[model samples]
Target chain A: MIRIQGLRKFFGRQPVLRGVDLDVATGEIMIVIGRSGGGKSVLLKHMLGLLRPDAGAVVVDGTDITKLRGAALEAVRRRYGVVFQGGALFDSMSVFDNVAFPLREKTALGAGDIAQRVEEKLAQVGLVDMGHKNPAEISGGMRKRVAIARALVTEPEIVFFDEPTTGLDPILVNTIHHLIQDLHRTFRFTAVMVSHEIPEIFEIADRVAMLHEGVIIETGDARGIQNSTNPIVQQFIHGAVEGAHHVA
Target chain B: MTDWSAGRETWPLPARWVEALGEGTLYLVESIGRFGRFLGQAVALVFIPPLKFRRLAGRVYFVGFKSLTIVILTGAFTGMALGLQVFLTLQRVGSEAFVGPAVGIALVRELGPVLTAVFVTGLAGSALTAELGIMRITEQIDAFMVMALNPMRYLVVPAILAGIITFPMLTAIFDVAGIYGGYLVAVMLLGTSPGTYFGQMQAFADMTDVMVGFWKSLCFGGLVPWVCTYKGFHCGHGAEGVSRATTEAVVLSCVLILIFNYFLGSVLP
Candidate 1:
């Protein structure tokens, strides 16, 4: 389980996250939804130990990751797989090498094993024959798939996705969502994804958390969140412009 | 003139100048502090375990071997120009024999290392900044960090150590090419006796002169990449940021090289 307690963050005196508290149970997909610039990505980063909170404890399975440093911190990070917004594929590397990077760096696997594992991950992501191409040669959606393959190549215990479907076309977005759901069902990795795809994301998320005004105002199952009475939640969910959120 | 006083009346000119000066000073100090911290981290990480020799070797090839032709050409041209000019000036005084010594000493003591450093800064340093800047904007650096890899170790240490290893070697090549070019001009073109030209250079240009060039190259090697990579690592948002960082890296590396060359020339024997 992942527990965030009293998490607060300030970027240059402007509060981005204010006393955010949340929890993610084991093997569940928790989708964090918010307006653009509401710090959803920042929250994901905090959980990954990429950014330390001003005041909070990110306890991962009883260990407070916020206080860990050096190798201790690295050990925690090694268990996590993150798919960044832009795929963040190494430009200098081919798709195959990009997917193979984590395994080559972290494990003592031999060349044959590494190749086999990389090929398996690529095939799982439906990019088996495209491994030799550079990331720049691939489409944006394909790049995201490559990123996902790289992330899961290490068989991490938890995976984080930041704006996974932000820039893709509608069809591609649905395809990506379905792919993510399929992978989650197969791997059963505790998944935390920040996205704004609305009704589509609701199809895959077990729980949806609404982040507003630097805090999680509401969190519940997708159906419960959709039927919530809170004006801010309603405004965000229904894409209403005139509401408490707009007034504030 | 009627409205100039009103606009200028917000503050005295001297005060405005002082404020600008203060801001510039603060920026400079902050940059120096950041550069020093990065250097310390890079140096410390260089000795750590899991040294990536493949990356280091690639950087060495890129920074040193790839720069050979340009360094050689620059050294040859500069030496030829110096030899010609010195021979002409010494001809008036019936001391043309000293042309070889003048050219050799200047090349060995100063121009060889300093020019090589400037060229490499323009070539490799700018490339490093642009490459890493793109990575920064594209989030590759953050990806490395997220993967439990230290960017300082994996990206920076190899590039820096490569610079340190390559600078002196390139400077030596520059010096040798420069001396040969000087010999070619003084003996073959200017009709100076080969014996006197070589004898005068041998008499005056000692190991200390070459050592000075080596030391300067070593410092320049470390400094250029240090500034370039730091700018790249901290580059800002997008394409504009990458371009700005690359420009800053090149300008700062060149400025630092010239400044340090002056100091080293003054201090070294």
Candidate 2:
């Protein structure tokens, strides 16, 4: 459902995504694992049209999102939900309002209907009673769930998780993983996740893409990622200090 | 609201005025530079490669409609107060008849324009800065670019257009209310002839004076939001940084309106 070809992006003079390419099919959860500052999040932003590639195209379900503009692009964006890292909830709005934002902004849903859908999505994220609370008032786990509920409020065809479990505790991380698995099974939507927690990868990924030095060196099924002979993959998965995946 | 001990005030007599004038002048220059940038983008929107009219209209409504209630409220109360204060001060001379010309001239030539602009700067200016600052620190502006939308067209142009359309109307409301407040003070409190009061207003009030005030007000309206949004968009850091930018926006807008009033008034005979 997503195709990115020869994607290149840079922040000022530093080249981030250097000619990367990848594709994922419908109803599959594709996890991208890489070290910090390795262009994983940059790659995700490019796919969402939240950041443009310096060269090439990011096609979501056949539309070249890099070419879409203004309301048209916003319309395209409404097709997918995004769970931003740190759960970038609006501080001024309540949890219910935060989840209802995309629906309110992008759709013509009446107040009662929006309230109903927001309640249902909040329940799915196990945040039933927390809707009245502000984002700062909630726990990190609950905040992440609020973010998830907000993302799903639009009933998007695809979802992007930008390091969903990065700041959570181990127990909350498992909760998020189970939630991801359950949602993937329940919603049957494509999931493009950026993560580094190795064990969590085994539980949630249908396929894994390994990004190294601004390139995707390996792309394989869940089991393929585990047994691959590529030295970079071995060093990374085993937490080894000496290998093709060098420190610094 | 009137706490004298919130923070220490160390400014001496001569130094205080100097700081006020200096800070006011510095903000005027900075505000002009930012306003230039906004005008450049807004003007370019007229001839740009791709024009987004609907998005631009939405932004205009944001700048104009959302700010309506505040502008009107400030105008009404300010007019009433100016009317009462100026009449009482002039009552000692027993030339209370001059109250008509005094109120009309102040409202039409200087006070009305300057006060409304300052009020808007405090109201719309701060909001603009905070809104854009949050968007900047959060990378929403970057997100717009990623979506291949020009931030200039989608954001700045509409605000400028709205200010142009809204400020003149607000100033007119200010002028009418201010003069009426003066009448209430003159006829009711000081027992002046209503006929002579209004007749003097009609005689002294020139089209030139009213026209210049409205024109200057429109210019201030555009300048305030333009500078506020520009500063916010280019701000550094997160919440604290955004908050500082907002404070500066409000302070600078008030200063610039006064500065613009002097220059624009100088040009008006």
Candidate 3:
């Protein structure tokens, strides 16, 4: 569903993504794992067309998003749903309003129809009857669920989760992961998630790609990645303190 | 950007200074270009179809109605102060009756719009900037973008439209309140004849003066939101970034209003 070829990005003198090449198949949950600040988010932004790459093309479905601009790019982006790391809920809005925002703004759907869809998504995320509450009034876990419900309300063809379970408690992390897995099974949208929840990610991801120093070091199924011989991948998945993955 | 200081002993001071001057000039030009484009986009979007009436109405309530009290109170006090000072000076020259014309002209042509703009900038403009800055920092803006929504259309157009609609109306109110304030001080507090005060003010303050204030207020209304929204939309990283953007938005907006007022004052009839 997505193809990125020879992608390159630079931040001043420091290079973030140096010719990264990857492809994600349709209806697959591809989780990209990397150490903190290892350009994982940068790579994700490039794919979302939020940041233009210095070189290379990002082909989503069949269109080269890099060449699209303004309304054309926006038209393509309508098919995407993004769950930001912090949930990024509009604080001024109630949870229901937040979820209904996309439908109200983009679709010609009646308010009744929008409400029905929002309520359905909210229930799927286990957030029933929580619509009246504001995002600030909810717990961290509930806020994440609200974000998910908001993203899914539009029934997008693809969903990008930027560390959806980050900053959550262990049990909540598992809950969110399970929720994502369950939703993926039902929606069957192409998923590209940037996360670091090693063992847990292995359970959910159809395929795992390990990023190191601006390149994909390895891409394989959960068992294949676990049994890989790449020292860098081994050190990262094992959380080794000292190994081929240098600290400094 | 080569480090001239690395070879300071060999590099001439004049050359270094020239390079720094060139860089500063380029930076200023770039900043002006960016601001001009942002303003153009914002203004153009305000006229686009599917005008966000709901958002605009909410912003008008926040920017216009909420600011009414401060605008009126400040206008009244400024007029009173001007009236008292002018009356005292004219008393020495046996021309205290002309204090009405002086205060009336000042408020209608200058003070009304200028003070109103500054007050609105301090109140609504700062809040708009901080709100947008927070949205940018928290990735809400990014969320909007990924949802195929135009943040400029949803957020900026309403603010600019609100400013354009509110500033002049508020200035007109300010001028009326200020004129009454002058009457309270000169005709009631002091001993100036009421007929003379009203007559001289009516004769001196024409529609031209009133229009000048109106135009100035209209221009200021657009300027505040233009500068403020740009700052917030392009604001830096976190809480500290939002704080800095808010400060810069207020200071830049107030300064621009004053500067624009001077030019408008000099050129307008």
User: Cα lDDT for residue B236, model 1?
Assistant: 85
lDDT tens digits by residue: candidate 2, A1-248: 89989998767557788888999888899999988889998899887787777888888888898998766887777677788787777776799988886676567899999999999999999988888899889988998888888777777788889898888889999999899899889888899999998867888899999998789989998899999999998888888888986686
Output the better candidate (1/2) by DockQ: 1
Top-DockQ candidate index:
3
Q: Model 3: which residue pairs collide?
A: none
Where model 3 places Cα greater than 4 Å from the true spot, the runs are B1-23
Candidate 1 lDDT, A112-187, residue by residue in tens: 9999999999998889799999999999999999999999999888999999898999999999999999999999
Error of 3 at B201 (Å): 0.5
DockQ (Cα-based) for each candidate: 0.41, 0.08, 0.59
> Judged by lDDT against the true structure, how good is candidate 1?
0.91
Tens digits of per-residue lDDT, candidate 2, B1-269, equal: 13332332675678767766887899989867876766786777858655566756675676666766776666666666776776788778867677788788888889887887777777777887888888777655653443334667656766666677777777888788778777776777667789878888788887988888888878987888677777787777878999899988888778878788889898877
Tell me the spans in candidate 2 whose CA falls farther than 4 Å from its real position.
Answer: A108-110, A228-235, A238-248, B1-107, B122-124, B139-202, B230-269
Residue A93 lDDT (model 2):
75
Which 10-residue window of candidate 1 chain A scores lowest in summed lDDT? A239-248
State what share of the real interface contacts each candidate retains: 0.69, 0.06, 0.80
Q: Write the per-residue lDDT of candidate 3 for residues A1-248, one digit (tens) a residue.
A: 89989998888557888888999999999999999999999999988889998888899989999999889999989999999999999998999999999999999999999999999999999999999999999999999999999888889999999999998999999999999999999999999999999789998999999889999989999999999999999999999999996787
